[model samples]
Target: MNASLSPLAILGIVAVYFAVLVLVSFLTSRNDSNNADFFLAGRKSPWLLVAIGMVGSSLSGVTFISIPGAVGAGGVNQAFSYMQVVMGYLLGYAFIALVLLPLYYRMGLTSIYEYLRSRIGPHAYKIGAFYFLLSRTIGSSFRLFLVAVVLQQFVAAPIGIPFAVTVASAILLIWLYTFRGGIKTIIVTDTLQTVCMLLAAGITVYYIAGALETDFSGMVRLIRQSDYSQWFFFEGGWSDPNNFFKQFLSGALITIVMTGLDQDMMQKNLSMPNFRDAQKNMLLFSIVLVFANLLFLCLGALLYIYAANVGLSLPASSDLLYPTIALINLPPVVGVLFVLGIVAAAYSSADSALTALTTSFCVDFLGMRETDVVPDTQAGTQVLEENTKRKRLLVHSGFSVLLFAVIMAFELINNTAVINSLFKAAGYTYGPLLGLFAFGLLTNFRVREEVRVGKVRIPALILVCLLSPIVSMVVDYYSAELLGGFQFGFLILAFNGLLTFVGLVTLSELGEPHGDDFTGTDYA
Candidate 1:
């Protein structure tokens, strides 16, 4: 292994890279100077840029590290099987395009939670936004925390920087790049980040293939012949975690919750000039995500092969495999590229989270809608706009502090398994959002006013979402002891979502007392 590049050299390069990002952000923000510019890029984003930026946003540092690491533990079956979930993303994207996008466009919403306000009530709207804020805050922190671990292990240690300092430094770089224009800046920067991420991943794959002395065709043959290339998933029964049906359904549900329903993902979609363009972006994003994930899986195989060829010690945790190889086995350039990719992936997701957090809180909780749609005729409009502007800044800054706190807590605990579980559990919270939107779009269910759910309402929805999955898990638990041991994977997310769906169906009224069923035109 070559260690010609000093730690100081690596830190210097990173510092310079962050400086460039801050400069980019300032320039982008300077282009436009209002709330619309900051929140939605004035809704004039090019479809291609949105598509490319979305790829980076979808696969965060977690996917960069965890997906490859997942290969060895899950074998070829569990490792590449996630691609099936990515395929399910197509279904979710279609739902977003045909159902969610039109609704958002028609309502002229800054945040998707505005639809919740229109369809259900203010309480539901706030609840939906609250879930997004809570889930995304924790989820993005977890992603960054993982990347922070990689830096602490591979870069910070040799460079004599504290892990805490490295983590803060990385986040501050993101804040610097993202604070001004938010998603507007992220749209351009994430596109650049995606290119960097792909270049790094692509380069690493090429080098590993070269080290193995195998071309693309030869590598395919190697993987096919290896003990880890099983692709079809028909054998695992309904109870099995990796069953095709379960994974497919879970994948679909995950797409709906994470992308279709979540404000972070949909904010990008809403930025498209029209519903048609947004739909195109969603479909393109799904296709790109599938291909990107395939590349990650290929990289994972090559990493293991390279490790075996050179007689390198594999990291105990699969997530560390990529970084460990880059640090201990690969060349200095490879290590630098690895760090760059990690930073890109982390920022791609985290920056979007910060922006969406502000959007949701501002639009959903603060009721900063374009309530006076009287053509913005006078000083009164400006006064209302100014009021909204103050609230927006307040919410954005407050969430920044809240994000810092969440990051601090995650660093203190540092339990990867618990963090991963929380990510899974967060999926359940979004299920209510999915059910709420589904109910509104699919049926004429009118949630009446004067009905008070109070603060317990969101918690209750989450409990309903979790209960059946817990019950199914308990059944599986006892059945495992009595018959054979059983384990659940991501498929549990599907059942959790279904439970929320059922909860919504039971709670929502099917018809209005004096009118016909909502023909979708009422909301439109």
Candidate 2:
């Protein structure tokens, strides 16, 4: 590792990157700067651009760093087995496009979880939305913290800045661009960031190939010939987390829950002009993701192969491998590009997440849709928009602080690979969400859709949703001892969802069978 470049160089790169994003934000926000625009890009975003930007958001900082590291680990982690999950994602995306999107579109929802409130009762609805807030806040904060650490380790600390300040600056910078244009700005800015990230990744691979005395075609051959390039793991059986069935199923379910069900991701999809456009975006994103993951895996294999040839010591933590090589071992230009790539990837997801949190909090919890009730009356709509802006701003800023707090907390205790850890936690929260949506779509039943049932009120349903995860967690802890050494892995999400569904059914009153019978679907 060189460790010779000045911290000033890195700070300059960060400044330039933020300038580009701010410029994009200014351009996007000029026409429409309100909550609808912020939340749904005014429902006018181009499908192709949304698709491209989504690829960036989906990749995020963890994929930027950790996917390659998985390859360096020389086990199932990066043996291309992750692709099984990626393949499973295609199924999940298709299900979302065909089934979930139509429902959200028909209802004309801003927050996808609002569908839950319509389907079950306010109790179930609040649980679903709150679960997303909990999951995404923790998930996005963890990502932002990772990038902050990278910046601190390589740039800020060397220049006498504290890690806390670095984290604050990063969040503040994202807040600057997103607080106005919101998802609209994100769609455009994420396109730019996505291009930069993918190009940086390709360039890093090319340089590593140069160091290995090989060209692009030869690099491909080298990866194909390496032991690390293997992509399947069928013989491991159900107990193996990387078992094909386990990984594939987990991947599909994760996609359906995380991307399809998640407002941060789905908000962009819904921003498109119509269902056709949204479907196009989903299909394109799903296809491009297959190749994207393939590229990352190949880069990982190349990094390890290059390390062996150069006799560079592998970092103890695999996540450190990509940054160590790019910033120190590789050329200075590669280091500059790596910083931008990481910042772009991290902020791409983080910005949208902050916006979604704000939207959910305002629309779901605070009841800001009172003005939206008079869309046909322009004067009434403007008044609603004016009032909504103040509330939206407050919620957005509040989440910014909440994100900072959670990230600082994560800085205290986080040690695992964030990508894996995030998904595991999501399994608990998103599990209930998945069940809530699945039960709504898959069956023709109804729970008390109001805030209370006579003596059987909101907390009872909330309690059921809450306890479902705890029960699932216990069953997961003792799975091996009690169930013939079965390992649940990501399949734990399915178990958690099953528990919630049964609970919902148990609480429900029998109803007349009808098509998509949700209460308050007319609210939107």
Candidate 3:
């Protein structure tokens, strides 16, 4: 394959892109670098910018490359079947807007896990936040790993840089821009990154059309005539991963758990001034996300069609197909767009994850309330604020290092398409969250936080949360044998949540339900 851009050129593009983000960070954080500004952008973010920025953060590099590649991979998400999942996302987003958003705003929460504490017990609260921390860490690490592999293959490796340095450098760059401004800076930068990502996908589709010697309508016709154009799968039965009902239900549950129950995604929504504005952001984001995913699936079909027409051999990993063509097979302009798009995708998600992780840790673990102010003179308040800011900075830096380490670990073990691995991991890590929230919202029973077992008082909520996923995993592994070829697929989230709800029920007693205003004490 002939290379269109040298390693230096690609590196230059990435540097210029991050320089713009750094400028945005400086401008956004210059006046206010306090915790409020860092965490929720002082609740002054525009709904539209938050909506647009979320498109990039939610899609990430996983969607950019994996979704398109999955379209033609002919196993999971074959052809337009992924659209069924997108359609399910609409239902999930509607639930979030109508149900979850109002509940969150009613509680006036900085961290959504606070809802668990107020409604259930302190053990439930800590357990909820722990699951989110685990989920987002693994999710963001997988995303960053995708971009690192691309860079190592196309840019860093050619220049004799090791993959670890490439990964470390990428994380460091994200940390530098995000450490001060936090989500406040991310709101603006993510909007810019969203544009870069969409443009890259659109342009690649256009160029592939030109190479196929077809116009826009003709390209559509070609895709329609192709084998990859089939969208719905009704006859595949329960075991087929691409079955319509399976994909649609999984899509809705995944969105609810990954977005509504997630800190990284919800932090952006919560940054808006009111729940109404946040609801608007969620609705608009869902609409735009549907179209964005459709565009990617179309691009995937065209890529495979183009490869076949040119007799180009497919890569070993489907995730590499987009970068392989964009860098070595297409024009230099497309190569540049690929670099910008991947970097934009990577930073958009990683920066927000880092901010949300820090936000959750400080608010949920360290007991730092967003509304807490030193009850003293102006000078004393400033001193306390400065001290709080130092703690936040340290936490933010710590998570960045953690992310780098996780990505390195992923490089050693990851063998499947990242999108698959991501959702599979989410099914386990996010299942407890789904279950905890479901129990709180849907049931009137109050759980006993501690259950006595043979003179040992155990945290029932934590044990339940941990065991739900393990049980779900065991059930999933032997599902075919036990259920006569019925596979759980992404529906594992729902099952895991159900197990948690049942466990919580066992720990509950018949009593008056807790009020919405209940704020339980932390256990010793």
Q: Evaluated with lDDT, which candidate comes out highest? A: 3
lDDT of 2 at 63: 85
Q: Mark the regions of model 2 whose C-alpha exceeds 4 Å error after superposition.
A: 1-4, 74-76, 370-384, 448-459, 513-524
The TM-score between candidate 3 and the true structure equals 0.97
* lDDT by candidate, in order shown: 0.72, 0.83, 0.89
Error of 1 at 429 (Å): 1.8
Tens-digit per-residue lDDT, 95-188, candidate 2: 9999988888888888887777676666667888999999899889877877788888888898799988998898899889999988889899
Candidate 3 clashes between residue pairs 3 or more apart in a chain or in different chains:
none
| Selected candidate, larger TM-score, 1 vs 2 | 2
Superposed Cα deviation of residue 189, candidate 1 (Å): 0.5
Q: Give stretches of model 3 more than 4 Å off.
A: 1-4, 515-524
How well does candidate 3 score on lDDT at residue 12? 85
lDDT of 1 by residue, 76-137 (tens): 23546666766777787777788778878887778777666666655556667777777788
> What tens digits encode model 3's per-residue C-alpha lDDT throughout 33-83?
888788889888899999999999989999998988888887888899999
**TM-score to native of every candidate shown:** 0.88, 0.94, 0.97
